[model samples]
Target: MKKIGLAWQIFIGLVLGIAVGAIFFGSPQVATYLQPIGDIFLNLIKMIVVPIVISSIIVAVAGVGDIKQLGKIGGKTILYFEIITTLAIIVGLVAANLFQPGAGIEMDKLNKTDINSYVDTAENQESHSMVDTFVNIVPTNPIAAIAEGDMLAIIFFALVFGLGISAIGEKGKPVLAFFQGTADAMFYVTNQIMKFAPFGVFALIGVTVSKFGIESLIPLGKLVFSVYGTMLFFIIVVLGSVAKLVGFNIFTLIKTLKEELILAYSTASSETVLPKIMEKMENLGVPKHIASFVIPTGYSFNLDGSTLYQALAAVFIAQMYGIEMSIADQVSLMLVLMVTSKGIAGVPGVSFVVLLATLGTVGIPVEGLAFIAGIDRILDMARTAVNVVGNSLAAIVIAKWEGKFQRNSKPKSQTTEILNVN
Candidate 1:
């Protein structure tokens, strides 16, 4: 018998999980017994993320012989990230205005979760200024940065360390070689961990469905639908156009990333798929230097889906409470989101934290968050998948622009094989 493909395994797991959860809705055993499979899978991924990121960034940066080219790629990547992300926020705002998803919604009728946790996080965020954010990027203790998994600090340290290696010329070879090996080993670890994805997806989806059930989404169905619909539109219309310009079919790219996308959606965490996406991008012919740098950096800067959802959700909350936001106020919300959303990219429950922070600044009640907290996981699933896709495409587009893209004629065959050691 032919073995099932990984994507199919995950898909089946997803379907089965939902079916099982629905069959045993409100059963404590579903979460009490079955949830740990998913937790273990997430922890395993988290355990390796810092190392994979540090090694990959250092190796990619050190491999860049031309410092000017490195600067060019960085500049162009950031520009692309900003432009696309801004457009995403605008599209989301426009959709909210048109759909008015929260119009006619009664705040009292909806179930409100305890939002004090999110509020506390947001309050803490308020005290930290943007200048502090930039300065903190240069870690006081690189070791502490890695131990804490501060991505911005780790990225900064890796870039400086890599550049120092590059500056020493021949002496840098040994350092570069070490990171290259570390990155390879981490990629291998990622693959080994991915082999358990089907079980993880099954457990994660099962617990989510069993606990929340399909009914939880009905009260806020309009908001849920609006968020999903806008994300679909963004991916198909906006990111699709970019793919067309880059000389590839967006559908093809999606097909190539089906496993990562499904895993991301089921897990509701893009970090689960980051290492795999980076590997897949390299397999799709994005250079390691570009894929490594662009994917990680894009996670921080190019959160198109998150920003869009934030815009839509912010408006939805306003409409729910009969609060009116002026055009200037909405634009101001976007500007604040553009800043607050950056460094908090891969943090768990990040959207809530960001929304909490920005909601009050624009006069939307912080308590308004409780309205959607129940459905946040459902919304998060969509955004996480889109984020993985967006970051992958960012790397490919930047690679194509830099004349570094080498489209594999045998992607199916190439992706399953181990990366070339030489």
Candidate 2:
């Protein structure tokens, strides 16, 4: 008998999880049993992320062997990230306004979770200015950055280290080979770890459903609907237009990333799919250098989905409290979001952190977030998928802009055969 593909296996796991979770809804035992499986899978993914990022970036930059070329790519990458993410914020704001998701809601009836943790995080985040964010990107100690999983600082160190290797001519060959080997080995390890994704997806979804039964979504369904619908609109209309201009079909790209999209949505974590995304982009004909540099940097700077949700959620919280925000007020909120949303993607509960930090400035109640915190996971899953799509597309756009995209090329062969689930 032919074996099942990974995507099908993951889908099966998702369906099974939902069914089991519904049956066991509100059972504490679900988390007690399933959380460990999910945590292990997540830990496995995290374990590989730092090494893959560092090695892949170092090899990519050194391979470019020209600071000018690297600079050009970096500039174009950041510019594209800024434009796309700004458009995402605008799209989100428009969606929230048009949908009126927060209207007609009785706040007292909804289950409000305590948001003090996110608020505390937001308070800390507010102390750091954009100038400080830029300054902190240059790691005072690269090892600490890696140990703490500080992506921006790690990326900075890798870029400079890679450049140093390139500058040394023949002497750099040994170092380059070492990183190239490391990148290759990490990809192999990623493939191996991916074999556990079905179990991870199953356990993670099971825990979510059990903890927050599907019925809990009814009270806040409008907000959930608005967020999901708006993300679809942004991806299909905004990012689709972008794909066309860059000479690729958005639908085709989606088809190409079906597995990654499903996995991202199921887990609600983009980091889980980071390694696969980079590998697949290279297979899709983006040069390794551009894919490596653009995708990881995009994680820090190009969070399209998170920015969109932050804008919509800020407006959402204001509306929830019956507070009126005029065009000027919303535009101000957008401006604040544009500044505060940057460099906080690594923070836990990042969407809430952004909203907490921005809402007070725009006259939205910081407490309003508590009203929707119960269903934030449902909203987060959708946005996480969009973030993955947006970042993947960024790699293609940068490659195209540099006149290096190879549309007609075939994907590289995998070193190991993917496991077949029977």
Candidate 3:
């Protein structure tokens, strides 16, 4: 018999959620009751983000002797991420154009979004141009950024701090060692936390769909389908194509990443899976240097899913408004999306923030966000899964490109068991 694992359990959760949502369509008591279970689980995942990010970054950055290699890896990662992300956006735009998800959208009386609720003015986001974007990475205050989970700032701080640790030479060894220890400990914590995956998935999906119901998706079904379809294509086609180009079976990579993807889907936070991905990559023969450097950095920078969503949502909103943007305007929007998507931290709700930033850059109405707010939790699963897959592939591909990949020369073994990778 095929072993029934956490992924299978999550599948059960999704199936049951669909059933329960359709069953008790509007019963406030059942819906409200299930809602908190999901909320608590999401909180659990979010609780792990900051420490893991800090520990992983410090550990990854400190161990490297040649900081110049960091630039090389960074360049390759951004280049690959941008190429795939732009393609992802094009896929989204194509799907939206063909399906016309917004053609029938009744924007007559726009339901005003609680725009401030999602906006991150965080004094740190003032950098609207390229120079500011690069400079904004250097945190004005590292403590505040970590406390607030401003990822770009945190990444900038970690890189600088790690460089400082390396500069300290022998003195830095102990501190770098400590971060590695902390990273390992966090992975342990992640593993322990991930034992809750099946239950969390059960609670999360059970609660979200149960509370929201199918009717919430009725008006936005086409949009949801198109966007998700675009993401699925990116995941299978884009990622798979890249994997093939890198000389590995994409199926094996997916199988290797199944547990992480499922946990990411359930928690909807890629940060929780950082330690796990690093460990998996190393085990699969990706250099420790590459695994450490690439995976965590990719979390903060290479957000393929968010990129795809920005393009789709921008066009959907424009279509809804009957505003025909010129080809030049769309090209400009692509450049903006490329920059903003990289800056999104691997945290919950950041996608919407990136979406808002993309809209602001293009002068699109932010109110369009409210249209999908009700079903966002659902859309989040797909996006987060795509992000995890995209980040994972980017790390490995760039590692291979940089001569960091060590082909598994052992007897061919399809790794089947899903370890607790939060």
Q: Over the stretch 130-189, how does candidate 3's per-residue lDDT look in tens digits?
A: 566567678878898888877677767877787787677767766776776676677678
Scored by TM-score, the top model is 2
Give the alpha carbon lDDT tens digit for every residue of 1-422 in model 1: 99999999999999999998899889999999889999999999999888888887777676665578888998999899989989889999999999999899977888989977767778776665667777888999999988887888888888888778777776667667777778778888999998999999999999999989999999999998999999999999999999999897889899999999999999998889888888889888988778878888888788888999999999999998888889999999889887788777656688898898888889998788897998888999999988888999999999999998988732222211212221
Per-residue CA lDDT of model 2 for 1-422, tens digit only, reads: 99999999999999998888899998999999999999999999999999999998888777667789989998999889889988999998999899999988998899989998887789887776778778989999999999999999999999999889877876777777788778889999999999999999999999999889988899988999899999999999999999999899999889889999999999999999999999889888898789888998888889999999999988888888888889999889887877888887789888889888888888788988888888898889999999999999999999999998897465333212101100
| Candidate-wise lDDT, in order | 0.86, 0.88, 0.71
- Model 2 clash pairs? none
Clashing pairs in 3: none
Q: What is the lDDT of residue 364 in candidate 3?
A: 77
Give the clashing residue pairs of candidate 1, or none: none
How well does candidate 1 match the true structure in TM-score terms? 0.94
State the lDDT at 353 in candidate 2: 91
Better of 1 and 2 by TM-score: 2
* TM-score rank order: 2, 1, 3
